[model samples]
Each structure stands twice: as structure tokens, then as C-alpha cells.
Target: MRDAEYCFWHSPAHKEEAAEARRLGGQRRRRERVVNAVYELEGMTNVGSVQRLIEIAVQDTLGLENSVARNRVLGTLAQAALRVFEATEFESRLTALESVHERRGKGKR
Candidate 1:
């Protein structure tokens, strides 16, 4: 006899497995959104507005009030910030070195 609660494809024994599959599917979708946001932001000349929007969207979409999801969002933001900071710092140092060399060349002439 077949169980009515589970239909033809799902048996009582597979109930938990079905639930797990649904949960994983949701997680995978959320991750794809995050990855796409990162790629989209990477191509932008300025990411401040877009990044904030994406963060809010991800939080809402992923239920990031939950610590695990929140941590992932925060970690991604931190990495982006670090990369921008390092690049800016390098540019500033390079500019200062060029200025000093230019002043020395002028003095020699």
C-alpha cells in the first residue's frame, strides 16, 4: 500500500531527505546571488551604492539575521575593503616617491 501523505515518488523514509534537499537548494540559490553581486560590483567604477544595495538584498534574501549568514556577508565586505585600502595606500606612496624624485631632478638642474 502507498502512503497518501508522501505521494508516489516519496516514501515515509525519504521525508527527511526531501526536506534536506529543499534546504540545500535554498542555500545554493542564496550563494549564487552573493557570487553574482560580487562579480557585478567588481566591474563597477564605484561600488559604494551598489555594494550597500547588494548587502541589504542579500541580508533580506538569506535571513542574515542568522549568525552564519551574517558572518559570510561581513567577511566578503571586509575583504573588499582591504583590497581597496591596499591599492589606495600603494598609489599614495608611489605618488610621494615620484614627487621627491622630481624635486631632486629640479634641484640638480
Candidate 2:
């Protein structure tokens, strides 16, 4: 029997696979849309906001197939999370320093 060539989407043998792919694609699109809307409305204005964004990216990236691109993205997100940690530390140190300076000024007066 001569079998006709058909693409995955049009192949009778691949109907179930194609349907699964379509369902996953729709789910991914909906998730991306919701993430985008939340990001736009919240606008990463603080450490918590920034960390949440990085966390979401990491979670989504983890679902991706293992590849060089996925690894690179995970590396970048890790760096970003580290930076947020550094910023939080710096902010705490700066606040302590300001408090010390204020006490010193009051004592000198």
C-alpha cells in the first residue's frame, strides 16, 4: 500500500498527538497573557515585585524542555534573583547607617 505523505497535524495517525499539542498551546497562551497583564499592572516597583517576577519566570522556564536556551534563561533568572537579594541587603544596611547617623547628630546637639 502506498501511503500519502501528510504533516503531523493532518496525519490520521497523529490526531491524538495534534489534539494534545493544540490543548497545550492554548494553555500556554492563556498563562502568558495572564502573566503579562499582572506584570503591567504591578510594574515591578519594589524588591518584592521584582522577586515575584523572577520567580514566575523561573517557574515557567523550568517547564521548558532542557536545552541551551533554557539553561541560559535559568542562569539569567538566577542572577536576577541574586541581585534582588543584594539590593535587599544594601537597603537594610543603608537604613541602619541612617539610623546611626541620626542618633549621632541628636547627641551632638
Candidate 3:
């Protein structure tokens, strides 16, 4: 008798179809990984200081080395970091200038 497992639907002749199914499954798995990475990055915003958040975002973006979306995401994140750094520097300089103004006013009194 023919092997019980070798029914016509499950026969070796259909191996290509089975391989295609496996390939699609792998693509779904990769998509899920990217989604999870996005959620992880979003969660960082709620839980960390700005510096910590930036660090985690950069590190996570770096970890997506082979991802199709990696370069786009990294470029956006880098632009955001530049803005944050510039704002911080501006605030610091403003505070220092205000401190100098206060001292000069005190000297005149």
C-alpha cells in the first residue's frame, strides 16, 4: 500500500507550494518584529528622561540593521536628536545670559 502520509494533497509533487507557504510565514514574522520594535520605541517616551529616551531610540534604530525601514527611521531620528540638542543648548545660553544680567543689575544697585 502507498504510505498513509502520502495522500495526493500532501505528496512530494506539491513541495513547491509548501515552500511558498513557509516563505510567506517568514515575511509575516519579520513584519511583527518591526511592529514590536516600534512599540518599544514609543514606550520609551512615556518612561524615560529626554536623554534616556534619545539614547534608547538611537540604540533601537541601530539594532534594526537589516530592516527595510532602518535607514528611513534612522534619518528621522537623527533629525529629531539634532533639534532636541539645539533646543537644550539654546536654553542653557539663555539662562547664562539672564544670570549675567542679574549680576550686572545687582552691581548697579
TM-score of each: 0.43, 0.63, 0.52
Off by over 4 Å in 1: 1-43, 46-63
Give lDDT tens digits, candidate 3, residues 21-92. Answer: 879999998887796586544333432346556677788889876675988888887887888788778988
Clashing pairs in 1: none
Order of all candidates by lDDT, from best down to worst?
A: 2, 3, 1
Candidate 2 residue-wise lDDT, 27-101, digit = tens: 998887797697653556888878888988898999999999999999999998999999999999999999999
Candidate lDDT scores, in order, read: 0.70, 0.89, 0.75
Q: Which stretches of candidate 3 lie over 4 Å from their true place?
A: 1-48
Q: How many clashes would you count in candidate 1?
A: 0
For candidate 2, which ten residues in a row score worst on lDDT? 35-44
Best by lDDT: 2
Residue-by-residue lDDT tens digits, candidate 1, 1-109: 3636666337676778778888999999888789768754443455454556555555664664568767777777667666766777798899999999999999999
Considering TM-score, which of the candidate structures 2 and 3 is the better prediction for this target?
2
lDDT of 1 at 48: 58
